[model samples]
Target: MKRLWGILCIMVCCTGELSAQKAAGFKGWFINNVKIANSMRTLDLSEQPAQLQLTFPRYQAHSYLVNMGIAVILNNNTTLNYISDLNVEYHRNTLTDAEQNNFSAGYGFKWRFANAGAADYFMAGDLQYLYNELNATNSLGGTFLLTLFRDGKRLNWNTNNFRLNNRLLFNLAPFAGFQMQEILKSRQNGMAGFILRPEFSINTSLAFCKKAGPPYDKLLAIFCNYTGRDDAINTTSFKEHYTQLLHTGINYYLAYSPFEVSIGASFNDGSDPLNGRTQQQYWQVSVNFLK
Candidate 1:
């Protein structure tokens, strides 16, 4: 970790210089944020969910990116499962002269879950191809995720593994590692960079409903992760500094059919120190829709 800090320190000191060499855009946000907290288990495999289906995100053309993609989970059973997705994206230039269209595909398998410990686990690999109008670039990447706890909402895959009774108060365990993360990125004009920073989030599902239901619904969450792996822990004080966002929102499930649709919106407080030594604070709106 010491060596990691040393490299991150150099990057911080030369953040401005580094951007001059490459297009920072929103990518700079990743390097600016770094909070390293230890985590426990990982996995969230609930058989109660839709066994298999096609999934897609809200298509927002107004985004810095106007893109679309679809994903499929071949299985939700204990026997064997495989998944895949294909996405095409267009990145608009927020600064400098950078505009590109990208296409990427990824595949991965799910593990057979056991109730004993961390059960929701998945690992996947990807291949991305990018075209900047001038040149083409290709890169390879993968993701590894594990759920840290057994959600009180679902039965453990192996019921014998968990012998706990559920109560209303036992619901909220603050700072527990129930976060889901994915680091998605690709090379730019043949240059490698963070497409999406590694992110961690925590939230509850308490909502005002017309009928009695699970204690938690309408996905409530707050996530923090670096804008990039460009920096690591240098000083312990650095732990307290970095770019991160807090989101208060609701996820409304629209369907349980072959296709699932969900829409969510959040009031976001985006924080960063790149403007200077002090973190600049601002408020923005985040709306997400996935089908």
Candidate 2:
């Protein structure tokens, strides 16, 4: 009996130590934002369009994206955060055996200022870069048969098809949100349960350079809040080179002690009609390491 009790105590101690380590240093989520069909509503698995019956060669575009974030506690009331995104995209044409590939990357930093409370406040800034290359042959019985359209531009040649959008966009955002913990308790394990968190932020983007035409460059709107317009010249709400927007999100999680599996939805109230995205939203399934 004594030996059994000693072993049980050791196991408990080990478990407690592991839990503490997870809580102290780890804070992030593995979020897949572009796994399925591109839609604003649900998390659908199929790549097919709303009309699922007919699949065409021109509609063969796939994007894979991952978003990650880590937070470090600086003090009792301050935390610093780093976030990143990686994306790979491919488009294929069966008729002409043409292909277009794209890669995108984003990095951001955030500062959270809050007391020990259920709700927290933060400010964040981010940047994004994109690159695209197209590969096609000019052989169609001495006549080029391959044609591609991108960003309102038409393409007919195999060369000069690569584009590098190293625009270096910057977004500054301020956010406020709350997390409701212990919404549901587990029956068997005391440390397992459910949690709900909803957050919103206002944001503005600045691009030092200009695009070739209309539809300004914008990225990482989901991390921003209620910044005003970017039109006027000399006002607090006036952003010089870009636009202002609002971003909001809600997350529902199933917690198992230091880990959580969650489903989240986010939206951006975009106002730039020329930028192509008047409004944008998405749903994501994620595994949160710590929060």
Question: What's the TM-score of each model vs. the native?
Answer: 0.39, 0.26
For residue 264, give model 1's deviation from the true position in Å: 5.3
**Over 4 Å off, model 1:** 1-67, 75-78, 81-103, 113-137, 149-205, 212-264, 267-289
Candidate 2: misplaced stretches above 4 Å? 1-59, 71-242, 271-291
Clash count per candidate? 20, 7
List, residue by residue over 94-134, the lDDT tens digit for candidate 1: 11123323333344343434445544443333333333322
Measured with C-alpha atoms, the lDDT of residue 231 in candidate 1 is 27
lDDT of 1: 0.30
Among these predictions, the greatest TM-score belongs to 1
lDDT against the true structure, per candidate, is: 0.30, 0.28
